[model samples]
Target chain A: EDQVTQSPEALRLQEGESSSLNCSYTVSGLRGLFWYRQDPGKGPEFLFTLYSAGEEKEKERLKATITKKESFLHITAPKPEDSATYLCAVQKNTGFQKLVFGTGTRLLVSP
Target chain B: EAGVVQSPRYKIIEKKQPVAFWCNPISGHNTLYWYRQNLGQGPELLIRYENEEAVDDSQLPKDRFSAERLKGVDSTLKIQPAELGDSAVYLCASSFGRGSYEQYFGPGTRLTVT
Candidate 1:
């Protein structure tokens, strides 16, 4: 069965502290791995999509890197506003090509 | 351009009551999706539409849940006799193509089952 699992269910960080979130996935063929940030009561905002192993994408303070079996989102100096739930989703090569998501990692960046 | 838009930002209704939510995707987007998000979890796809045809809805609890996207533009999701466990945020999103590009999400409708 295809599934995604994220580690450290919750994390608390002081302002300007850096951290990393991990997302491990098991699937037949991983088409793409996606990262998203969601605030309370709002929809998730797309962050980045990693299509192949050894690929990486960065935006400001957030960086996403992908490996053959998993991915990691590294936050370089987080801020209070960066506090939110970070979700990991995988697009499998199954016929449907739908996304399978993990429960996510709740990140609280306090000032 | 504006992003995907969903109405009824929040709703509170008694159990077993019927309710409906609407969504308007970004203009010219060819694919639309509806997802259910429970607290502390990521969104789960309920249905996905390519144009006006529902390509995938196997996860949708069709017995009481119904959705439609007429004219291939706007869409609506309805649930009758909602259960307590049904309290969740309903999110709508659209992409320029069917998963061929990044998706744009709406604010979502937070439904409360009291």
Candidate 2:
């Protein structure tokens, strides 16, 4: 079975503070790793997709990196607007290519 | 390009009642998906459609839920005799194709079953 686990269920950070959210996964063959940001009462917004172990992608103040068994979403100098629930999902190489998602990490950045 | 569109941003209905939600995927997108998200949890796939055909619906509760996509553009998900446990956010997403990894989502519809 494919499973994903995210650590630090909730995090609080001061403006300009930097922190990292973790996503660990176990799958038969990892096709891709995805990161999404969801605000209260809104659908998740696509952030980045990491395919290989050494791959990394960035957008504005957010950066995502992947490893053989895990992935990290690093928030640099975050702001209040960046506060949202960050979700991690993994896709397998076979089947319908459905995504297996973790519970997610809730982030609160105070200005 | 316009993103996915969903209707009835919020809905509240009594248990055992019927309800429906609609979605219009991005133009030219051939793959559409419906997902349910419980509070404090990630979204779970309910059904997936490639154009007008449903390619995956393994997790859907066929006993109460049904979905349809017509002309490969717009889709609807309906639930008959709703249950209190069905209260959650229904999200619609679309991608260029089944092989596309990135899915753009719409503002979900919040359903409340009392």
Reference A-B contact fraction recovered by candidate 2: 0.84
Q: How good is the docking of model 1, by CAPRI class? A: medium
CA error at residue B71 for candidate 2, angstroms: 0.9
lDDT per residue (tens digit) for residues A32-109 in model 1? 999999888789999999999999999999999999999999999999999999999999766778878899999999
Model 2 has a clash total of 0
Q: Report residue A8 deviation for candidate 1 (angstroms).
A: 0.9
DockQ of predictions, in order shown: 0.80, 0.89
Off by over 4 Å in 2: none
Which pairs clash (backbone N, Cα, C closer than 3 Å) in model 1? none
Provide the overall lDDT of each model, using Cα atoms, as 2-decimal numbers: 0.92, 0.95
Sorted into a CAPRI-style docking class, model 2 comes out as high
